[model samples]
Target: MPAPPPHSPTSEEDIRWMRRALHLAEQGQGAVEPNPMVGCVIVRDGQPIAEGFHQRFGGPHAERDAVANVPAGVSLAGTTWYVTLEPCCHTGKTPPCTEAVLAARPARVVVAMRDPFPKVDGGGLQQIRAAGIDVQVGVCQEQAEDLNAPYLKRVRSGRPWVIAKWAMTLDGRIATATGNSQWISGEASRAEVHRLRGRCDAVIVGGGTAEADNPTLNARPPGPRTPTRIVVSASGRLAVDSNLVQTIDQGPVQLFASADAAGLQPLVDAGVEVIQFDSDSPSDRLAMVLDHCGAANMTNVLVEGGGDLLGGLFDLDAIDEYHVFIAPRIVGGAAAVSPLGGQGRNKISDSPVFATPQVSRCGDDVYVTARRVSESPPKSVSFNP
Candidate 1:
């Protein structure tokens, strides 16, 4: 019988190993913006040897850490490496990971997905092949793509991946007729929102929300880092005594508004950074906010809303993901505010479509997460793997 093909179908064990690498990659989630989360594992003689993950921006690539962790006397001459992303071949903050892998002399390499950044693209794969190492690509590709969605989105679109989050009653109202929206969801659901906030680069809210809620908007039980706070208003009229303005000493807060908005001088005097946009149109204002975020290298933004901002983002088709918490209670009133309120669609056919949502229960609330169906798949560098 003929020998098996060099790059045969992936084995169950190989898939398991790749999943482990992917999980390790997630450890770098909130810390590696503008850089994809990457994990690497080395195996020898059917047993694992070393494992490592990209821990922070401007740090050593995953491959370097994995290779460095190999037991002092273990030779990598016959070992195989499994990496969530293609080994990088170009230098930026650290040396090329491809060079590091070549130095270790691994016998074979398996990559979950090709790096989409122009600097590496398929160059890393080519370099590995040139060195006579067997290469396999596309192991656990879907999970790898999902893991790097934010970085890939930023690299391809020049804007952060936007996620809109809100908690509303079963009747779809965010607040009562008089704008009383103290606690819609249970503690578990609220805690989940804070965890989501902690993972993003910034949390945005409308000026109306700032004045009415006086929310601090910081992540409770903070993680490795806290997100920047952003308030958007056409007139820039935010309450001077609001908690957001009062917490300027704790973290950075930015106000985006039109150039002529009133009462901004006081905010500036209070040490709040004010960004002036050229237009007052909701769509234009959102575009300006995203542009500023991109310039600041912020890859993920959580738009925690008070209706107007969320409605504007939906009208502009700017939201990439949605996380809606639906509580069981109902408070019916003609003047009650819905989670999204604007000049809505005239016909049912004109409504925006979303992918099938993932729904789960959080205490007394149902959590629904979905992505906009119109979003383009992350750009990928073409390679056989």
Candidate 2:
């Protein structure tokens, strides 16, 4: 039929447009849960031409949309396309993006890296080159993978994304021996704390935790809306008349525990979803709860805990990440609870929590965010009530 179309990035503006395409991909964050948000920029002869990003599951994927959106009649020869993830080859919700790329018939294809999947893995790359197109890999490999980790993680393990948040003293104490913790973090840090909660699908805490702390696990953001509040009470004995458990008409409250059926029955009667499991392991229970919520794209759980729960999750290696806020004011009580050091289980290794990098900030408080260093001893919360 017609000679497809011409495509080439022939100007500095063209290259800038390509960069903007990648930036557009960032918008998928928060919006593209359970799936990694990805951006793509197609250029011909180093000029900005077309752009796209993976917005939602049923929506058009980044590379495919970008290629298809290009205006007709542009010379397809001698143009280069930059995409975050390798264009997907197999069609699921949308058609194979590789086919779209080949149809465009650009001079060169520059992708972040080969796809790490099996079904559609690297098939796009092969298909394009098979059609006589030049392909370059690893333009920004790390960033691409980082941007797509949520989708990759789900694709690999059918599990939801997870992150842990806690406030510890300078000396690493989570609570005092007396068990009085009115305010652990300052205002700025607390504001940031709620922000993390607002982003998660659920917020989790312990039963003994809810009882002792009487926490309002609701992730109240600056505005009225907040994430669902979840309490991990294995005993399932939260005070029916208690303030925290009493329905505020705010949002739904949940409890995960193994308490006496009678004690929990009342809450169930009050319209609470009680996830009664055979055991009392937070990590195990959490995985099930997250799955039940339909972790298709990306969902996160922000855990704000006291010492026992924090240590438990670490011992189990269930914690995917840790974002700790440390107020500089020294509350060096001899028996202060720690973000990680308090007691559930101990490790023989000098530092059991093998870590990647610990980023610390002390604007109003010294905040430390760390990723689980290694999987070898990746232990998770081991509290059995």
Candidate 3:
């Protein structure tokens, strides 16, 4: 390793610097759907120096790109690189960022977590050491990995990813006996849901759902900035002439299924882009959808549908966050709108299961937006969507 630069450490300033740099990571907040925020801190000869934070998708990874902004002649031969996670070494939607760090020739490397991922999994540290640089591991490892869960999940499982939306009644019901779901939630809450949809890259619904409800599927009151509409149909037929197809700015619809191309021309010609991927693997299915949208300048997707899709995703251990709307009423018939799944049992492991909903009331309806929890397992329950 090269000789260390002559300088003094600023423990107080460096810690504060790390915190401020981490905030720059949100640039990828809405854009980097499955990627979490990662920050980078660079120091030389004990003196805190250049810093970088990954802000969004297609944006620079914190360590590599940040090093670029540092004074060019300042030799990294003595600088120390600090990253929230293992630096990426695989060619992904972006380049293998490990090369970027290598190019800097930093004298030492300090990573917060072990890259359990196969592609880079320790490859970064190995590469750094190969070049005769010092490598340090496990600096705040747990917290850093927790911060970048989405990205880590994507790295481990190829999928577009999912976050569930829920709505219900005070007693945990979604609607009345006759399926009359009106005024259950108030104007303000519904309006917020619409806005959330607008920001999403697409809104996914199930096939049986489209035919049964004939739902417009468009983000209501927020339709102008309509999200790309997606329908999951195993049978391939979802009423081509519905209001949703005609009204949605981005579609007739993108269909995901094993359906024959011959039967889907009408939808295609009408303007929807149908992606025919026939697979039963939930992980594969999600990955294809996410790649399609993520590559097409769309990443964030909102799944707003009847309980079937919601429950299925939850059952698959796919939901990340939730929004549940509760109305003030009860029902008495078998016709009452229950959650996504019918009576059934699926066991869950003893994981960190908890819900924290920020309540907001509208008319007789109430809504709870809960933060994502860790270690969720499969179970039977009703979550109104």
**How many clashes (backbone N, Cα, C below 3 Å) per candidate?**
0, 37, 11
User: Over the stretch 193-283, how does candidate 2's per-residue lDDT look in tens digits?
Assistant: 7777765666777666678778776655532234567776666757777655575466677777764555787887776778776645556
Residue 199 in model 1: lDDT: 85
TM-score of 2: 0.77
lDDT for model 3 = 0.63
Predicted candidate 2, C-alpha RMSD? 7.4
| Candidate 1 lDDT, 171-289, residue by residue in tens | 99999999999899989999999899888889999989988888998888886557889999888867778888898886789999888888788889998899998885778888999
Candidate numbers, best lDDT first, in rank order: 1, 2, 3
Q: Model 3 residue 344 lDDT?
A: 30
Q: Rate the local accuracy (lDDT) of all candidates.
A: 0.86, 0.65, 0.63
Tens-digit lDDT track of model 3 for 205-269: 77866766676656665532456778877666566787667765644468777645457778777
lDDT for 244 (candidate 1): 86
RMSD of every candidate to native, in Å, equals 3.6, 7.4, 7.3
> Candidate 3 has what TM-score?
0.69
Model 1 residue 104 lDDT score: 85
TM-scores, all models, native as reference: 0.92, 0.77, 0.69
Clash pairs for candidate 1: none
Once fitted onto the true fold, the runs of candidate 1 whose alpha carbons sit more than 4 angstroms away are 1-9, 346-356, 374-385
* Residue 173 alpha-carbon offset, candidate 1, angstroms: 0.9
